[model samples]
Target: MNTSKRLEQALKKLYTAFHHNKLNPECCKQCAVGNILDNTDNWKYLSDSHGALELNYIGKVHQALGRKFNGYTPLELLKIERVFLNACNYKLPLHYKNEKPKNPTDKDVLFNGLNEVVKFLCYLDNISNVMDYTKLFEFENDKPKYKLVFTN
Candidate 1:
């Protein structure tokens, strides 16, 4: 039908797949919508002492003095958050809430899907410069043992 509808269909298809067992865990996402946002630096920051470093790095945007925003990119953090939310008690699917998605064959619902994902990506790219991308996370770090500095 339309672009939005197409994306919604994609989302339902992917969600259904994940709900059942149709697609891979990481590949079925819409613009990499933070499927596994947390702990993303372990592989994404692959470089100097930071790559898989102890998550220490913060401070003024880029200059970051004593450190502040360190950790991982907003995109990465989102992935982690999504994964966590998915596992949380409140993230159950509509079907799971009322009925049950046990047989996720063609019974998937395209609620928001990729349209939501595209909007998010656009938002991210739009405000990429003014935002730290990392601060938008609920990174449950009580004390934040590590610091993450953005070399970008």
Candidate 2:
């Protein structure tokens, strides 16, 4: 599969963050978009609030100028954050009264968030979801449709 340079880089960063235990839903610098943007929290300024799809004044300027951070526009970063937060069961716009996971750092919770973020990223690049494995379960005429092979 030929993935775009941006998608490849973003996926690598996300994978590293996930393995390093740096992926966090509540922290702007450790969230999905943050990791993709080199673990910087500056992307947070693109929006007035966390998980908001609307861009603030600064964000609008960047969007209008076609400025991209790590190959993603300011609005794209906000959308990525929103998708991540939503998949992690975080209430939008992150507030005190919003519903959130009791253990936000749990592996399962983070994995769920990463799964959706990856899907969204792939969607943006018009590619297949890298994390999808359901095709391995496909069967034809009571026979396994896809073979799992290990190469050394």
Predicted model with the maximum TM-score:
2
Task: Assess the local accuracy of residue 49 in candidate 1 as a C-alpha lDDT between 0 and 100.
Answer: 22
Q: What is the C-alpha RMSD of each candidate to the true structure, in Å?
A: 17.8, 1.5
Please identify model 2 stretches exceeding 4 Å from their true place: 141-143, 147-152
- Whole-model lDDT for model 2 versus the true structure? 0.93
Instruction: Quote the RMSD, in angstroms, for model 1.
Output: 17.8
Question: Residue by residue across 27-101, what tens digits does model 2's lDDT show?
Answer: 888999889989889998888899999999999999999999989999889989999999999988998799999
Residues forming the 10-long window of minimal summed lDDT in candidate 1 = 44-53
lDDT of 1 by residue, 34-145 (tens): 2223112333232222112223333122223332123335333344324322322123222224432233222222222332344443343343322234554535656544
lDDT against the true structure, per candidate, is 0.32, 0.93
